[model samples]
Target: MAQLSTEVYWHSTEPTEVGPPLDGDASCDVCIVGAGYTGLWAAHFLKQAEPGMSVRVVEAKFAGEGASGMNAGFVQMTAGKVLRRMLWYYGAEKAGGVYRAVARSILEIGRFCRQNGIDAQYENTGILQVATDTKQLARLELQIKRAQRAGVTSFRLLDREQAQERIGSPTVLGALKVSGALLNPYRLVRGLARVVQEQGVLLHEQTPAQTIEKVDGKWRITTPHGTITANEVIVATEAMQGAFPELYARQMPVWNYLLVTEPLTDEQLGRVPWPGREGVANSLSFSTAARLTADNRVLWAGGLWYMFGNRDTDPRHRRNDDAFDKLGASFREFFPQWRDVRFSHGNGGLISWSHSFIPQFGRTDSGMVYGHGYTGSGIAASHTGGKILRDLVLRRKTEFTELAFVTVNQPKFLPAPFGDKGGEFFIWRQRVGDRLPLLLPYKSALAPNRFFARRTGSPERATAGRSSD
Candidate 1:
């Protein structure tokens, strides 16, 4: 019922916001477009891998202005190692390769944070997957069977009491927890960007790449005020890669919202058993919570329900709105005492290629590689995607590098026409799925929710999961 504005909540005390727009031509061996997680981290990783390599990062807005800084911070690494799902779709060995690749990437993200002393406060605590009803539980069980078949031992079932005790949430039947971590996405990006810049990566903010085309010899990206010419160009904007409209066809945009409660003292947090600051996700789609930031800010993120489904000029995501209160309701359901917890509403946007429901990576053309479509769970995958892109850029042909993103591209459904108006169709389902799980709080009670499942085929159905917020 209220306007969710992202701009308002995006402000935070962090590294200096790089000012002014881009002007004058800049040249580098590698040029990255889009300052979000993918682009920013690509620059960082490239610098680390090839210290002397010249890298330039260009952004349409401030570093955190895009979906990178505006996210739910879940990093949602539980159902991770999507290789298993790929195995389901691909084969035993191929899936295993994809699985191992992502597994390595998760560890790599943690390693980067630790090695850089980023103070990301990463928690290796496992993911909690719950099922509120029989059908959903059936899905979870089916997933367990599939995962077990794939030799993924990460999923463990906890009864209602165990889940409640472990997660400090009353409305859970069982949980599947896994080793993962969470952090302030803003802090993660800002910290990593700061460190990367210190190592000599050129980062230009507030400069939109107006046109990206191939010149006589190499790739040249034109901005409103300047141009960047480089041997290689990386387009990592995900759903927001407007510079190349074809990316729009390849991916769809999904909107999610999050809320930051007034700091809960240790006494208040005592109710939650999920410690080590591990982010917790419910059995339903996209429902999750995390203890992030050094000050003990309990960040609760949820919802793929596009609050602004039909607005034209304005984007779907906005900040400091009444919708956050509805999102905070998930927290109250789990930790009832937190119901009274005052919170600041936060908004975030996502660029996802959910039609295929996969993270797209690798060379789209000669010397041009694109890494995107993390949907909303870019926290862990982007790190890997960037690494794979780097490897491909360097012409590395190892198994780990070559097979990272080969097959996930096909079977993707692109909504017809440019800027399909049916975008909210995806959001509608996610909102319904999230509320449905809660509406019917037990495994047997989930019947009413599935009644609506018959109608789901939209792009959002993939990310319509619980929000990373």
Candidate 2:
């Protein structure tokens, strides 16, 4: 199949446009360059933490127009990280601390919405990570143990039978259920913009940064219509950091796409069961992620994802459509019963990738406090990143420096140009354990992409997807 090519997702149908462009020189204590959750939240919390500080946001397109708006909307609690990685990255205890920071972000989001009077269809129904085979089940077991040690209160292990009953899918051999929330990412972004505006933060949309420089010992971020002179500049544009090359080298881009089925009839809905409205991902991790929306549609995504905003750059958006179709067809083979269901929308967007495939945060040599490279797992991490960046500028301690960035000796990401063949091959090796049952057991270093086999029917449950925050 042609590899998936965009990250714009479920809420792609939601309307959007560049906010009014910058008109002239703007001065602020802190200037955020992207309006996605990270930038907006930075503005909001900064105002909360220090109300007098001037804050401004500038976006190439509208808020949520990037990964934040184009994801499966799964708010990953720290409860979702692989146990071994935590052990390796932070040596168990510290890893748990990182996880705690992520877990707390869920509550932070709710508080942000309620306090701001922005209703983004936030539902605290939790999430499910299912393993479709013995190997995957074993991986789930490690995750369960790790979560327990990390002090996570809401993670539970489900065996094959119990998992099947809980998810209404017999293909699942194991699952990890934990506390999380579902959201209309589009609504969430809109709500954030509204709140940030109310808090007195200026927003500049459709204003791409032509150049960023430091003049007279201050940071100057310039666009076509205006410039932002601030004590500090926050580069929250996770994937599209085209304005800075240092960022591009540290954070790479990959393609992922999502499609939603027409609202499932009460009849079809009955056949598929979930506990309230939980988000879902697969245990194998070939980058598939899915979620239940505020509406009844099931939104799903996978593969080489990219985003060309406004769907204006190219019609057919052929690459993403094929990825969506692959996911749809895979879903059909797993549950032939849903084949006739109509699809109301098909869309794609971008997910940021760090050199280490880990989300990163902190300052740069250019005096630009940077926070990009989510590598598709931004949801809760984004919130934490914002807080960390805020602290960095304010001269406070942050865990950002401690988190391990995806680097050399780690799985060398496939070189560009090989495309799908290389991607699928890499995926297959990492995931073989999941698809092959007990053959290889599990390893934090064990890649899960090799296991992308069999319909398993349920794609999202096997791997958590990316987000804009």
Candidate 3:
């Protein structure tokens, strides 16, 4: 096998045009931190809602340099395990409402790409959630039950034969076919940056927000090069939330790794027989996700590693050999027919994770508006979050702002040492449960309790439907 290059495959898809950083003290009606999907989408919707509003976005690096560019490109509806928790906490109505919004966002994303002439390689191919063992199958069945209770019918169950016909994986005992897509996330975010820029939003790349404060009924954000003052600010930094004092306890950054192989030969593709070319993920907490690039290279990503006190910003952790080796082994196991396929790229990045596994979108005590904590499943959800941020900033009680995730108080992780130990335990337990399901089932020890069963009223259920576009 060839040595893996420690570079993100998606970054090479196109040349990045870095915008000029904040030159001096600047002020806008709204200032956004982090130019990833959440921040950029917020800017997009904000401009659409109020065309005259002055919006500015600042990024530590170029756009999509964080999780937006580093993810496995699964435009999926799955928000980690948040849907299940939402069902437990807020019941079917609110949970279903949120799910439908995100589901719509997926189609809207494709539509936006087409309308804006952004070739993000958006494909409407549904995602396949496969089960390799009985425990995982049980998990999928449970998910289907919850989805049904939440008025979702698009998650169709497929037996082993049917699942194999879609993915050609021998280990797939059964699968849940859901509406989603696989696209180049970096391309999408960069395209979004361009669109927002054209809409008169100011984008400053290579400018990191170092200090944020609310003073005299206005928000102030200080970057390395300059300062920005605004009537409202959106802190959309996902994985880097740990850097901020107020957000540090609310989310922890966990390192997730990915490996991509060179383009497969036609014979190799023929051997796999994946006609749908859908993104596939196993039914595990720390599940492996695989997708095909436009160029036919196989991209595989999984494995979660958390550093003590959320030290994921360290550049050294971006290249994890153990994680890459395990991912390569998993690829061979899933596709033994292509056992000789060698990975060309391997990279790792941080994912902002909340304790509840659901995204938290609201303002802080300091009154700075923010939206983040997608838990590694933000592609489509961030679009929904963008609308919510717009509504929040505009002080409008739209359906987006009244969603359960926005209204309910989010659970917080323990501070510092405790959080680090708690995160480590969670990762270890989930991995063990995934590997040894018979011995240690997932919900056996980590089941939700009565404390999280409060029912918050939500908007009417979204119509029972599936993605058409």
Candidate 4:
């Protein structure tokens, strides 16, 4: 067995190119902080909308160095339970709109990859939300009903035998095959940065925005390399948003980990025989997902881990031995045929989780535009987010800006030690709930929906307006 390497495997898929940092004070039409998927996509759409407009993106490190390169490469539509949470907080119309928008983004990403000639290893193999037990199967059925009610027609149910035919997981009781795709996120993000740069967008690597403020009716961003002033500023930092005091309360960073097996031999591959190679994710809040790499390795990830500090993104948090152990056990249980297989890599990344369990998009109180908090799923949503941010920045009243997630009054996590404690407790309770069948009745209590609903009265009351204002 090979010793598991901590490096993110996707970054090794291709050569990384880093642009020069900002030289001195500069000005632009728009300045976007954090050059990950959200920031890069926003810049792409902004330039697409107004080709002549000057846009500059400032990154603390290289573009895609953050979650963009480290994520599980799932271009999924139903991220962070947005479908169910949107339906619970907003009406079916708004929820359906959000779903449809993301679904379109997934397809568009594939098209964008093909058109741009980026060999991100894009595959249109849809994902499978599998259930391992009766309880999880019931949850899948409920989600199917909710999806139907929301006018989503892409979900197709597969029985145990049918699901096993695709995944060969003995533990899979059933699954919901949904429209999605998978790709090398590092390649996609780097490709996005390159494409945006080609379109005359200045990408300044190693330029961290230290402070942002309003001056003379314009936004001024102070960075390590130089200061950048722009007519508009976009805070697209995502999980790293907590680093900024101005945006800390809006989101929190939770560390999640995964492991990847060494490339399987022809005999090992024959044992599984996954022809479609669809992404497989379980129906748990702290769920696990597995996918096949283009190199024939099995990447298994998912199992949420939150540190005491909501903003913690230290390099040390990238490796959680206990989580990796749990993942290995779960993988063995799922695919007993591959019980002896060894993981060659095991690493983790932080995801920006919103208090509402849905993404937050719109302008902030300080008059700057922002979008983040995709929970764990963001590859496809970030593409849609870019278009939404474009509309918001351009002051367009398009359907993208009218979605429920584009509101100003998004719910916030509790402040300080309390919020940290609450998060720890939530994880503990969920882990306990997964084990004890007796705790099934109190499972809904784990979500903040009931509390928010009672306080706000109705969906309309909770989310007041369609406009960002």
Candidate 5:
């Protein structure tokens, strides 16, 4: 049998030419590490805001080599339990503002693609979060109520009948429909890189930031073959930011897996009446998301989140046979009518998970601004993150800076061996939780406990649903 392709379907479809790495010493007004979504969007906004600002982007690999390209492509608005925690920490007013900003970004991304003529297979197919069991249904209902209380009005609860009308998933008891979008992630990131380069932002691929130091009021970034000195530097490396000592204790890199099935024939597609092509996910801790590709294939991901000790980013971790087997079993369980559907691709990527399960943005004492720790959801949020990074670089006290993610002090994870062990333990517990419902067929109507919400100092137990993209 042929081995499953580890390359992500998105990157395989459209390959981008790698730019030359930095050759020697260079200087710029702003230097950004990691040419992924955060860096690319930051550069686009910074140049648009101040056309003459000399912005330079340095990448460890080609653009979109990380999560930006490998993600499942759900531009969702759900921020797990972070919104409820924000309400308690920053009060309802500011917390609501943060929620609105991320929601707006989902639309803004679509607009950006349209204006720039980026054919990234952008679709405004909203997200459908289904409840596979009675316990999950209770969680779904509670989540809708909490979302409304937090000033999110875009979500609507769907009964089983209504959900079945949309997508015939036998496991779906009910669903929460929300406004979200789906797109070709690789195409989007690569297109953004081209657009920014067109705007005169210098980009160097295959250039890794070996070390960073501040000397004479300038931030110096050292790469293997070259160095970049700039008035300001933004570390947007996301999961890979652990290389910096200051950020090491603030985030953990967790591996997220994905699989894409071979294109379904029209007769096979007729078995499931998914005319809307909505981005769909179930209410599991490590949720499973599925969406139809432009070519009629089904892309499913999540349900198994892995973490290697020392937060390693080995390429070998990209393909997990165990994860693929579980995902295939899940696909069959959800749609028994298409039991023989084969997968064409299987891959995984790293997600920077913060201790608080919220994205972090702030400036270090050394004058370097950073943003990461999106947990598993960053596609839409990263656009907002880009705006926040821009405001931080400009040193202007704008609404973006006042958001909870910026104004609050982000909690740190346990150090070193403890951190790694703790992360592994957490993943193991989640896996056990995922399997419990199967062993015990009894379903509970009571809402499940919200551990992250309580840990974040929130009195209300918000729903536990982590969207992946």
Candidate 6:
């Protein structure tokens, strides 16, 4: 195996062109913090809506340097890990609307890429969520039923034989197939940044917003080299939101790891039956997902999720030798035929999670518009979030604004030591859940439930949700 490459596969493959940081003081009609998908999309739509409005995006690092570039690249529609919970929480009608909106956003992303002539290696190969055990199979079946009840007809369940025909994973007992796409995430974000800049949106890289305050009714954002005063500010920093005291208790950041295999030769690729190259993820609490790159490399990710107290954002968190070893081991178990496959790169990034396991969109009394907490699924949903942020900043009560994600009041997470302990316990439960039958004797269902109830603000049961790719 090649030595582990700590850099994200998507970014290391195609580095983005970045501009200088904010110079001196500047003012704009609207300013966005963080140049990831949420920020880029907000800038893109805002500029498109009001061409004359002065819009600016400030980033701590280069665009896509965050989770936007490090994610698994599965452009999916299902917002989080579960659809049943969404239906139960928001009702069938509202849940169906959210699902439809995300589905449309997936298509819109593809359309936008095509219209802008961005070759992000986008492929509508769809998503295949496999179940490796009987327990997981039951969960998959339940999800199918819930989706149907919610009027979501796009997902279809497949048996072992059918799933094997699609992916050739011997451990797959069943699979849930859904319409989605795969793309080179780094290229997509880089392309969007270029397009938005061309539309006259001022994008300043390496300009970290150190402090945000209100001065004379306008929002003032202070950066190391300069300051920006804007009529409105959208905080799209995702996991980094923990840095702000106001948003600290709203999300907990967790690290997710990924590994990419060396490009498979034709004969080696032929050993697997993934003609469609669908994004595949097993139904584990900490799910293992695999996607084929444009160069035929297998991007295998997930399995180990780590969270340190205080929501650490250190880049050193990206290098986890043990996590990489676990990922490689799981890949071999899933595809023994590819046992000889060598990995070319390995990396990890932080993903934010709300107690509700849903994305939150709302404005603060201080007049800041924010949308975040995609859990582990934001590639496509973040596009929808862009629309929500746009509507919120413009103070428009449109369809996007009325969606449950926007209209509903998201529950806050437990504060401090309690939250940290809850997260540690949650991770333990997920690990046990993955080992299921083999570890049944050591598992305590009620203890985890009670612990979560005490630690989480929401009364709803805590479900295992994945971080977005």
TM-score of 5: 0.92
Q: Give one digit per residue, the lDDT tens place, for model 3 in 343-461.
A: 89999888888787888899888887878788888999999999999999999899999897798778888886888888888888877777673544444123322111221122311
The better-scoring model by TM-score among 3 and 4 is 3
The lDDT of each candidate is: 0.62, 0.65, 0.83, 0.82, 0.83, 0.82
Better of 2 and 3 by lDDT: 3
TM-score of 2: 0.82
Clashing pairs in 5: none
Please identify which of the two predictions, 2 or 3, would achieve the higher TM-score against the true structure.
Answer: 3
| True-vs-predicted CA distance for residue 330, candidate 4, Å | 1.2
TM-score per model over all chains: 0.82, 0.82, 0.92, 0.91, 0.92, 0.92
- lDDT for 268 in candidate 2 is 86
RMSD of 3: 6.3
Q: Candidate 2: misplaced stretches above 4 Å? A: 1-18, 78-83, 148-154, 303-319, 398-437, 441-469
| Angstrom error at residue 250, model 3 | 0.9
**Clash number for candidate 6:** 5
Better of 3 and 6 by TM-score: 3
| Residue 178 in model 6: lDDT | 77
Best by TM-score: 3
lDDT tens readout by residue for model 4, 381-425 = 899999999999999999889877795358887888888887788
Compared with the true structure, what per-residue lDDT tens digits does model 6 show for residues 339-428? 999998998888988777778899876778888998888999899999999888888889999888887768887887888888889889
Report the lDDT tens digits of candidate 1 across residue range 48-148. Answer: 78999999888777777766776756555425334335665666565555555666666677787888877655555545666554545545545555555
TM-score for candidate 1: 0.82
What is candidate 5's CA lDDT for residue 443? 26
